[model samples]
Target chain A: MRYLLTIVADGMPEPEKLAVLQRECPRWVHEMDGRGVRLLGRELDPPEATTTVRVRHGETLVTDGPFAETKEFMAGLDIIECANLDDAIEVAASHPVSWYTAIEVRPFAGDLHLGEAAAAFARGDACGEPFLLVTWMGGTPATPVHDQAVADEGDGWRRDLDRRGLHVLGDALGRPDTATTVRVRDGSTLLADGPFVQGEDFIASIDVVRCQDRQEAVELAASHPVARHHAIEVRPFCNE
Target chain B: MTVKPDVRQAVDAAFRNEWGRVVATLIHRTGDWDLAEECAQEAFAEALRRWPSDGVPHRPGAWLTTVARNRAIDRLRRSERGLQLHEQIGREAMLDDITGGSTPVARAREIEDDRLRLLFTCCHPALSLECRVALTLRSVAGLSTAEIARAFLVPEATMAKRLTRSKAKITAAGIPFRVPPAHVLPERIDGVLAVLYLTFNEGYSATSGAELIRTRLCDEAIRLARALHELMADEPEVTGALALMLLHHSRRHARVGPDGELVTLEEQDRDRWDCAEIEEGQGLVEEALHESRVGPYQLQAAIAACHAGAAAIHDTDWAEIAGLYALLEDQCPSPVVRLNRAVAVAMGGDIDAGLAMVEALTSDPRLERYYLLEATRADLLRRSGALGRAQAAYARAIPLAPTDVERRFLERRLAEVRATGADESGPRPS
Candidate 1:
């Protein structure tokens, strides 16, 4: 199983704590990577530096600030492949931030390789790959004929992307209710079963694909087989 | 002036009926929600422009779908980007899929399935509860952003952002658009039903605001539930949910006094209840009960039916109502449900037992902020002839009441309790 380790703190840590994070984060990443567990890791810019983009009724709307506003600020994130949730918990606990702040380990809804698209980012090879997060929104129970069409038509689009190496990773997620949320608090590793975000229109499946730009991303998103009867969104990872 | 009034009316009606279908179909073919919505909106706009001159098409849904598909294709072809997306059209979806190309029965079945899929997607649990409500109203029910925003008391921009945020999350999270498979269908259907019920409740009693009722939201919820019942006729909970809404909505008129004071069910004028709605709701409750697959809504509807059937408050079967509530408590199990069951138990007979039940509930931290707990205790105390205790309970409840109308009602009860220091019956009926 793959889990996303989200490092968060109540606010900016003291400078000495920052120096400790800067000192420990790389060592932690190197160790995880040495173990072939870390697929990707990045220290994000602050929330103020974040930019939120949304396409509504075909119009691209851009706004300043993070995708969501909350008190606890996300400082960094890492994607790690683990044997099971217990192993993932051990890995999170090893991180220095877990002792002082908070580290949330959430599994991806599906298979993904964030490193696959590192070259295609808008900022070019200077930064990581800019992959469009193709989320397959909700769909109704498929009619017999519709399912056949998807098997016949949908796989073709995905395969073509794969053949060109544009498609990185994709798969359906476990049910949201099956989701397990983990947190390290007061020297205790607390575990709860639920997604981090409490939102409507949950994720059904996801695709990570390299796209030329937002227009191409939208176009590509529009072409998924399930996109016919369902909702789909094409967004870039923030670092992109 | 070229637009005939009838043509305009026809287009408006078709937009209401066919907008969801057209949009869903276009999105399926083109693989773009924006394109689908834009094309569907344009199709209606086109109909308003062309219907008078072209004569009203025999099949307005088919006509609208064809126009939307054509627009989607045109827009795709014209857009500078998307060589692959434009190539996506090469697969060539059957245009008649939206129109139900085969037999009439097949067409109706397919269209309904599409609507159901949209509903499930709109009500997916991944989205926040608010987003689920907003999306269902907007995407599935075809309410505009402005209208939905107004109904929810959010700014139009905020509603627009919410819709965009929801759609983005759907794609970002990969929420499938289909109805959940058999294994998860029970829970997913329950989720959909919850959204509609919550919507109805929000309108029936504005939880936070001063307004006692917001019928528009209640109407929207019923409209959606009615449609859901049609789509999933075999789902007893859907039928029960619809029945419950109808039964509760039936009392809208009598629920408030002439001066807009909130009236307790016992104090409401029974003659003012909408008889036609009660009859329809009662019929639905009967039909759902016949399924023998009782859920929370079925139990609730049964309790409401018990009340609706009675000619006078005193004539009502409180014991039966209490029994139904017990079933409901077993079904969902909430402090609020327990509170309601206590009221019914008191009405049935044993005041002391009911008071004990109510008294024990006070310790629950969850009910600490729930004003109804205090109010219920006050009512039971008053009934048991503990006027001073009842007065204190009522005064405590008045401050905790969420709305002014409810607060004023509590005040009235408090005054009545205070005035009647000594009564042989030992309590004043509110």
Candidate 2:
């Protein structure tokens, strides 16, 4: 369970105590975060720096003091994940803030109104999303049998994609042995017989597939038998 | 209004043997120190209440374990932490092997292993030395806060607060409740062994009090060391340390005379020594030496073995013992080790060599106030026929001696030197 702990304190604390807190609290925060207990925390500006704006019936009314007149104000806040309420209390009690101030803990509901795209992204659901998979193969010479195996593996992947109704469009390019690079510099055209950059591997194929999300595309690419000895890079298409 | 004597004895015995196990079992299952300790204590309290009328259970440890475990389960079920416990238990699958289709014997073994792990956790090197001692006494020895405070001569509230801080740090720092891995074993074992040795020494020769030995503290240290040796049978130093303590303790029966005067090793009655303990300690020393990788503790054990194995002081192999002390000094150099080496060298018939070593130690500020330094020098001087210097050294040491027994011993040596007329004409080193 996750809880937000609001550190409530009166006006300003003693400077010596504050100095001690400044030196030690951040270390505690880092330690708690390392333990995976604390998710995030931040110190808020003091009450004097607070600016409160009230929006009533679309009319904005600005005020000096942050909230209502109360005995204490929120000085800082921490979001922590714990076992449950008791565990959350335990974590909260360990905080240095609790030494001199109150730690108000409450359950965190998270943001519930994120739009469809963002919601899907948060859930890791790539439904109806498209991606491009760039298949890499060796530029090094291979036997005819190895070449045939690569072709057979690609075909098997295409068939599996078709069965899953995720196939969109894909193509196997000619070997890097037949590739060329063209460049124009200072109104002069230059040509090369191979890739411009020298590396052990080259792009051998490209696949455009529509799936639930990038996760599904990654799964499909990983399942491709060519990925056993080669590499498959799956990139989600950003349609803007 | 009266508690039955038999029931009280059973409860006390059970608490001594079963406290660590019961607390360990709960801590292993729950991962909550406070909860485990509280529930275990509650179980003991319940035992005290019911055992008289309800009759003692056939298997007291198991009964206590079951009752404490049930109490922990109840606490977990009602608290939010219970869900975390379940999740943790599920992930680790720690209880699965024992709880799922295991024999009663296997379950018993697992609980005993938990107690050993608990000791390691309590004596972890990450904790401060004082904290480690306090935690081990409380968790492993089943000493109450008041008892611990009284033992160490601290306030009860202070001891309680220290224990609370240590537990908080254990949880907050995520110190694991298990023995360290083999690679880190030596350093961690040093920490554990140091605690056990200190505990034993405090009991063997208490810093304060009229009594020379507190038998309970020595017993607890020996018990803990024996358990550690059992768990880490392959670690030679563990065996060495256990052997060293056992050998020293074997002579405890003869260490002090009937008049409560300090009995030097040469004057001690070998017939009063524990032959069984000497045999066990000698066996351990032999096995540890066979490992070939010697440590400080192993070297010290070998030295003790020479003393214990000998029938009399004349039969002792001082040369071999001196060689072992040299090896130990090389492994860990300290004034105490050097002093011991000097004594062994003198006993090995190299009196001048021992006198030279003690003279060199006179300039060391660390040992300036140490009474043993002066005492050892006094003995060496007396052996070399420098009776005047020996008497002066004994006078200096007698005032600096921490214990009454050691003071009396030094005074006796001073009287012997004066009576021999050697103090009248010998030149002083000054």
Per-residue error at B243 for model 1, in Å? 0.5
Query: Compared with the true structure, what per-residue lDDT tens digits does model 1 show for residues A69-140?
Result: 567655666667787555676788778888676676656654554543532331245332444443433334
Per-residue error for A130 in candidate 2, Å, reads: 40
In candidate 2, residue B218 scores what lDDT?
Answer: 82
Instruction: Identify the CAPRI category of the predicted complex in candidate 1.
Output: incorrect
**What DockQ results for candidate 2?**
0.01
Winning candidate number (TM-score): 1
lDDT of each candidate versus the true structure: 0.73, 0.72
Question: Clashing residue pairs, candidate 2?
Answer: A126-A212, A126-A213, A127-A212
DockQ of candidates 1 onward, in order? 0.04, 0.01
B222-325 in candidate 1: lDDT tens per residue? 98899889878888889999999999999988988888788888888999999999999999999999999999988998999999999999999999999998
